[model samples]
Target: MSRRLITEVAGVIEAPVERVWPEIVRTVPRTELGEHVLAYQGGWWYRGEWSVTPVPGGTRLVHRVYDVAGQGWAVALANRLFIGFRERTRRSFAEGLVHLGNRLGCATRLT
Candidate 1:
């Protein structure tokens, strides 16, 4: 089965679309947000990508990660064998977006 996961963050950044996309999509790790932005807690590391777009009210952030495999028999029964993992990833994205919003909002002096 093909596995897909999508998460969106709106109003996540106060900076202009031009100003935010670069940092948001940077390949390097940012200390402020921690280097393990997308690492799986007790498993092998995997690569992930993030996208940003300008929406009517704010910017939209999207994250996609792939090739995630399950550890045991439980996963065989699971639809994607990575449901919990994807959920954790979703939470991580939400947190980073919220933090990014606060940082950019402060920088932009947007109340």
Candidate 2:
């Protein structure tokens, strides 16, 4: 059996959640984040369930790493070799949001 790692990052976007959602969405895509994100090959991140939604706190990005047959090894490797993946992914997404927000019109700066 393999366990998936799930986490959330909340940030205020000068624009509404809907406005910010699309920019945020792109970073998770392989093309946008392929350089910075780890554990990815080709144009996919990992075999998982994902969603973005609006909530009282802010826009919520949810990602789940799953194990189904062949993916069992990936889950195990992620656990053993990349235990810090959750934090890394969180930071990557956060930084990406800042950049996207800037490009999309918001001038928020992570630096």
Instruction: Give TM per candidate.
Output: 0.54, 0.49
Off-target runs (Cα >4 Å) in candidate 2 are 1-3, 24-45, 48-50, 55-78, 107-111
The global Cα lDDT (0 to 1) of model 2 is 0.50
User: Which digits, one per residue and each the tens of the lDDT, describe model 2 over residues 1-111?
Assistant: 343444444455455567665664555443333422222232233444444556554444444454333453466654685578668866876776577667767644221
Q: What is the C-alpha RMSD of each candidate to the true structure, in Å?
A: 7.4, 7.2
Q: Pick the candidate with the highest TM-score.
A: 1
For candidate 1, the TM-score is: 0.54
User: Lowest summed-lDDT stretch of 10 residues in model 2?
Assistant: 35-44
Local distance difference test, each candidate: 0.50, 0.50
